[model samples]
Target: MSIKLPDSVPLHRGLIREFHDIRVSDVSSSFVSCQKEIYDTLMFFLESGIDYEDLCPLVKSNCDTYIQLLEQEEESQGFQTKFKTIKENYKEMTESCEVFDLDTMDRYAERDITAPQLSKLLKEANDGYIPKIKISITMVDRILRAFPYIWKDPKCILPDSLLGDGFNNDANEDEIEMAGGSIELTCPITTLIYEEPMISKKCQHTFDKSGLTEYLKNSDTNRYMEKDCAKDGCSKKISMDDFSPDTIMSLRCKIYQIKRNENNNNMKLEALDVL
Candidate 1:
């Protein structure tokens, strides 16, 4: 709420442009990383000989039914192909920002208002007003929804008359889906390593700084409400006002990068020695 902005409309325009660019980068990365994480998870399950499909149906039984989804994407030539991995398709989706209308947001006001807000701001660089799509409350919500599914087990994918959990009496614990996973030291929200980290004053939990800022700024209902900590099980209130730059975490992250590189080099050296 205490966002400081220069009154120059030209500056606001630059700021707004920067906001949109950063958002596209953030959102595109989220789309790729979330799918990549989920892909790795399922691949891990398959390699471990786990029957992921039987254990964790995309939908749980006793829930509302919906159509099952599988990747049926057509390539540039309009030929659907499975030769490319699912991760590659996710990358293709990111180029379009997953089919989201960022420009429509470029004109958004509050989510509750239906009118486009872009034209409301001065186009002549005479006022400091920033467009709502430039800040994108929609993006904040989209990122929030996209990241969580990476860790959740696919609910029963197709809940037809034959496959409902209630109808399937043979399902067992070994076949049931598990929650969350480990993928190195990555942000829970982005599923990537930390960049521009911020520590939550309330819970001491850390999140990518840009992600946290957006989360605090947007409300799904466009009404004031407190946000809980982003950590999976933590419930402490998180506010934009309570964040502090984390220099220690920054230094520690550098150390992590160096160590990871060193270990990678060592593995390469050992492989060469064997040859």
Candidate 2:
């Protein structure tokens, strides 16, 4: 069942802009605060009449980093490339629905992996005294969470969503039934309803486990050669190890089976009533 979100592009574009605004402007602003903190630390040391000559390098180093950042914003090719590449990625997310999925969610989380990289940058700007950056990818996180309805096969509930006005909440399980969007029960390879389905990790296509394994074994390949996936139109090189039991698909099949049985019983009772 698909729900078309009316006018989703503007909201999505806004979210992307907000994310980059945090990444670029907020982080850039934090650099100034960071520099002040460094100076304040040095001032604290000097007022105590302590020998802080070794720490003077940190001030110059921090200033250099701040200036380098300004220069990058002005004309650095390296910075331009980085900015362009990330902007292109965001552009795709705003304009295309093809990339939203579990794998991309994993990647989004990986992008904000830790404070270590920021700490390392601060250390590079100094001589390893700083251990933090007062920044997080909060806007990016919000953008990713805001578009659950856009996912091709949504696997989890988003913590939050945007465009509450655009969503038709009635586009639910009952909508799927009313639209005759029956769940696929049969395996493409075996033409049999699933008993235990195994899915290809790379392509997300499912097939009958034993039938797929046997077909792959008999394909045009030897011991060293990996067989192309048996699923029609898919060319992903695959082996038995590449397939795994899909619990969610299995659960869907079970639900389909139960619903089908109930429907058949209702038809039988109606036939008896007609007599």
Candidate 3:
């Protein structure tokens, strides 16, 4: 299942922008608020099953904007610099909220530590703070409840044994042989063709269907289509291979590998703009 969101929406981009807007445009010195927002956003993303690669661009942009703002705050005497302090408070909050079960603890001890009583005693040592014993345990419970999804694998196979090695069965022998070989092949594919989207001028053809078909037919290229063309309005059999390198069509190719709206049967797309 995949989530369907508009490519134009830039979901993460907007969220990050909102965070920045709050700092400069709204409340100026509330570090805790900012920290909470950040935490909430992180939690939202974590729960949404967004991969790190997709989230990185927005995060990188956010960090760049944040660092500049923080630097400015540091220079201003009146501005209360609270980013670090707030971040630490957030860390502390998350740490205190850790949850654990007695059964789970015992299981961990049996599997890894071998000294269950000693491990329990060590955990107990951090109990006697000024806020008292109960508060720590409460926080631990909160942490556990809030972060149950953490460290969960979105896709993984269960091991047969309690402890077993992961294996990849899909790897081929040539891959293994090449890895072991000392000889290096650095040259790129000599006859490599750029991913040039060919549009036909005639029949208002956007992709080179017939041209590719004809090229393949001639070359006996059974697997891959061999020809593509981009002529504005000509009916002639124009081949992409014949087109000048610089004249390659700039038609955009968007691949929607992830879709967010799988569950919402009622929801409908109002528009799917194609040029």
Best-matching candidate per TM-score: 2
Taking every candidate in turn, the Cα RMSD to the unseen true structure, in Å, is 26.5, 28.9, 26.9
Instruction: Tell me model 1's lDDT, rounded to 2 decimals.
Output: 0.41
lDDT string, candidate 2, 118-153, tens digits: 323324534423223222323222222222221222
Give the TM-score (vs. native) of candidate 1: 0.30
Q: CA shift at 269, candidate 2, in angstroms? A: 0.3
TM-scores, all models, native as reference:
0.30, 0.34, 0.19
Question: Please, what are the lDDT tens digits per residue for candidate 1 over residues 1-275?
Answer: 55333222211323444534421112434434544454445334334533333424522321111111011111111121221222244334334332224443422222321322232322322243222221122322222222223324212211222222222324322322224422224556766777887766555566787677667665666543468877777768878766786433443354355445556777899999999
Model 2 residue runs over 4 Å out of place are 1-183, 219-225
Best model number under lDDT: 2
**Runs in model 1 lying further than 4 Å from the true structure:** 1-184, 219-225
Q: Model 2: how far is 97 from its true place, Å?
A: 54
Error of 3 at 250 (Å): 45
Model 2 per-residue lDDT at 203: 63
lDDT of each: 0.41, 0.47, 0.32
Cα displacement (angstroms), candidate 1, residue 19, comes to 64
